[model samples]
Target: MSVPAWLARGVFRVQEAAMRRPTFAMLAELERTQWLSRSEMLDYQTGHLNVLLQLALAHSPWHADRLQAAGLADAVRAGAVLPSDLPRLPTMDKRDARDNVERLVWRGVPGGVFPYTTGGSSGEPLIFYFGRARQAADAAGRLRARRWWGVNPGEREVYLWGAPVELNKTDRIKSLRDRLVNQLLLNAFEMSPVRMDDYLQAIRTWNPRAIYGYASSLALLAAHAEARGIRPRLDALRVVSSTGEPLFPHQRELIERVFGVPVSVEYGARDAGLMALQAPDGSLLQMSETHLVEVLDAAGNPAEEGEAVITSLVSAAQPFIRYRTGDVVRRSGRADPGGRGLAVLDAVVGRQTDFIVAADGRIMHALAVIYVLRAIPGVGQFKLIQHAVDRLEVQVVPDARWNDAAREAILHGLRARLGATLVVDLNLLDTIAPEASGKHRYVVSHVPLHGALAQAVA
Candidate 1:
């Protein structure tokens, strides 16, 4: 259905305000209360599951049918269902969720639904619905993290992101509005060596209190500055937060060393909002009050630490129950130690789409290669591509700092991780190309579908 232009503009304005106002404050309070409450963690999980189930039955046809099919219509009558009952429900894949967007979307309510699109990093573009209330709650969670670095809304902020843009004549007005809002917009697609130099100068001149952007882009800037022996004074900035991709330990260390600020890391997906954030003590804490997180094993049962499955508690417009996030995270410890209840994300591996299978049925993630190759002294940029089940290719762009020892270290690391039986080939290249989304994938598998083999691959 076509929406009126004025209505669309009004929706955008409402969403922007909700993302930056009193709603965020309420969300922070709710998160604190939930963590401090004396209730058992299992009871909290069941309560949230029932809430989401009720919302699904009321609004989302996709979820309604799935629940009915599993004979769960009465199970959610009074929020008394057991945790063991959740496994009886069917699993929903990304394609299934995307195909039924209309059934999942609610319309004509002030804070009912918001349309969003994915970054298409996996070569799959999708549009989904999110409730404004949940979106506001998510905004609040982000603001709570920002508080760790002394950032406040309405203060001057700079955003460096990778969203698609139209550089038309209309950009003049948009630029003016951005400046009026005390915000600066930098495109991620235009990051070259020269462009990065200009960005550094802009930061030094504007001197915003906080800087937020993709971790990879910022790491590139730090590397360039280190190589050129140019250190710009950024004393005005209190914090630096990196999102949109996994922030490597080496990158975080380098950024902190160069900028002289604490580096905060966060994780999120476009379909949902912020999932987890690094606390002051360096633990990645899940937003338990606003969302429910599950770490499932290969058998689709709850694992002590495995793949992350999310069930958004506040999204009434489109319920995301037991939705696989394609991310691998391990549970930090037993749930609800003491009265403080929060799921701790111990570690995050690469995407489920980027796993490589070995002949012995072991699965290896892309970060394994990154952890090894990044330790090599002279490696500037690297990419690993898997052409078959047991064959892999490694491409590296070397800097002047690399020597024979660096190459040997990389080779040895690969052999150790993939086992000496697998074929490991290294190719020296001037540059490594990024994916279509302007992000790099550390691993790519081209093998056709095979059930058990696929499980082994992941």
Candidate 2:
């Protein structure tokens, strides 16, 4: 059973204190900063940028060299770096973060650094470290965004997320922690027919004020509920927040129709941090206090729409200044209708990963298989193609860590998810080629979901 909102809030605060995270403190600051005017917002971002650059200069030798080569080393040291000076430095990519992590990371940052992995739907598995400041910023930013939709912290939020893994002890502990914080985690990784039915019932019983999850995963669950003639009584649900992938128009319509609440899109990357989130006014607003997002074309020139390169102000544990996110986004060039000074994003053309169908007819999120590859060390840039129900192929650009054990781990992990009868073809390559369309996708599946499930998604 879910705890009362007041009790949840108290429990959350106590836990945050124990973890030494300034979550609520940061949230309080963000709550006030959200009202800054456009120029004022820029000033806020610039001040934070200066601090981050100084941190990188002092602790991160790799970034220090880059700053010096960009001719801004002295300026950064003097705490006089401006927003315009950002362009002087070259952009860093996922490979740079992976290969030069030791040089990029600041192990001595206050509050400590913790390692995290994300294969992101982009198929690039990245292992990055973040400190409590970043952790607090992400949490606070989401809290600020949720307030825009009339949903406050500790108000019974349901996460159709991927946290509940196959491991038993870890799963139980996570489940318990989620409850104390007044959050429910329905496994987005499993999502079989039976499990989805239980999810529908759980959401109804919990009566959460907000539902947050992957866009496609939420759509799939909504479709399942509709097919089974289950219209959940979710009067308390203020918004259904979609993240992980782009919320296509059709998916939005379906989710809104099924949930009886408006659907909101949340755009962010695991490596780049949270960039923007949709407000009640329907504009995607950047986290002005924590992130500075740039839309640059393929040639690296500023554009109305192109790739998103972010400078995370709070990421002092590992500075990500001018880091290329590989996400295609268009700048709105419009002011916030809600009267906030936050910058807007017109659209985010996020990469889509197709669903994988197990041999036993279980529908799994692409992350299900992606996790198999991400957990195994030595696998570099990789791609997974599901050619049929029982057949799958994984192409990997192996790094120095690739070995006999890593190869065996790949086979064992994939089989564990796709079923033991699965036929796995593992291809090790020096480079992963883009698709025939000159676009790169990390996961592709030729097999389609049959019957009502297919129709709901279609």
Candidate 3:
């Protein structure tokens, strides 16, 4: 190996060991746990769940009240609370997390707490606190999942993602860090044809072991590449990891055909942390190491297809015990077809956000508009439908917090991100109905990206 390549890997190893905030310890542990018996894995998870429960009871007022109300507080304190007994706790929604951030946060966490907000893809934005251990778990879980496909840490890979605008500074530093890790990033927010061509060339030159990106963006890139006959001969690319949205069968086929690699679907929300990743055997296995996911029907019964309620085991800084994720998922009690000990999820039927074309010719993820509405407090539920490149229709169901200032805030927010030339129409509604499929999408764009995506972000 080249000296620098070896040096970077060595440095990362030292950092992993020395770093208390987020070490690679969990990644090492995952190697053996994946093959453990299902009962054994549950036992392991139950151990962590008990600790989290005790911590939440002592530190978090929100969880303490709920646990007490459920009459499980004393049991939890007496160390008799089992993981199976978790569902007894009442479920919390986005608003609960938002309104109770202070009460939920364990401000005295050792590594301190990291405050952040969701981009509002789930119809509302929430400010939550996550500690370093939670951060470490997410990173390590991903690394272990990558190893399932023979891709190791620091291997050459490409990230086609766009963080929220406020994370620009962090993104810049991350870009530099990515380079050190032999990773390249191609912005998904600005996917002009010219930029995509550059990305294709970069991917070919980089010869990455895998490609990771949004399902739709990758599919669109594949479509554009196929249309223009710009397929790069990537000999080392082993897999295409798709996240941020659902991977439709057709999109998967197109991506596989163009990239000549299997598409692995990763399902989770930022608020909940990394929940599950697709296994090599094609099973969507929940990260049983740090997450306890429950699938419940509308009436709150355990069903085949229903809302995904997640209890993040690592949510000690701010417990999300029995949190209603508002995502539709089907889970299998049957062992993972992959023969892994991780629990299997039949599917994560979550929000299908569209690609919005900005008036200035930028192609943005629906989360961009979701950011506008979610950031406004008075806006309860909203949908932004883009009918044309220059027009956006916003349907908002105002809440008690709604005021005249909120209306102006929405307009200003949209104008700032989408550009001034775009015409935005606001409509107040009592409720926003889901589609025939019974899926509620906060944002949908009818305008095609055929030529619109040809213009990269300026």
TM-score of candidate 3 to 2 decimals: 0.91
Off by over 4 Å in 3: 1-5, 11-20, 165-167, 170-175, 376-378, 398-409, 451-458
Window of ten residues with lowest summed lDDT in model 3: 449-458
Question: Who is ahead in TM-score, 1 or 3?
Answer: 3
lDDT tens string, model 2, 111-172?
99998888854567889999999899888899889999999888999988874243344666
Name the better of 1 and 3 by lDDT.
3
- What's each prediction's TM-score? 0.69, 0.97, 0.91
Give the Cα-based TM-score of candidate 1 against the true structure: 0.69
Model 1: lDDT to the true structure: 0.66
Q: Model 2, residue 414: what's the lDDT?
A: 90
Candidate 1 local lDDT, 1-458, one digit each (tens)? 12333453344456477554346456557556546543566576678778778767776788888888988888776665665676677666555666777887666434556776552233233567776667677777876767656765545565765443422334677765555555566654444456767778777776776777777666666666666677779766877788766777777887888788877878888776678877666777777776677788778888877767777776677777777776677777744433356667876764423545555544433444555665565775667787876787878777777799988887787777666776777898887776775544656767543442232222
Residue-level lDDT tens digits of model 3 in 1-458: 21255655666667665666464777778777888898899888878888999999999988898888999988887878777797787788888998888889999987888877675554666778898888888888888889889888878888888766523655666656667767677877777667778888888888888899888888878877787877678898889999988888888888898889899989878899999999888889889988888788988888888998888999899988888888889878778876789888888877677888877667766766676687787887888889998889999888889999999999998988788877889999998888888877788888776642322100
User: Number of clashes in every candidate structure?
Assistant: 0, 0, 1
CA lDDT of every candidate: 0.66, 0.87, 0.81
- Tell me the deviation in Å of residue 201 in model 3: 1.5
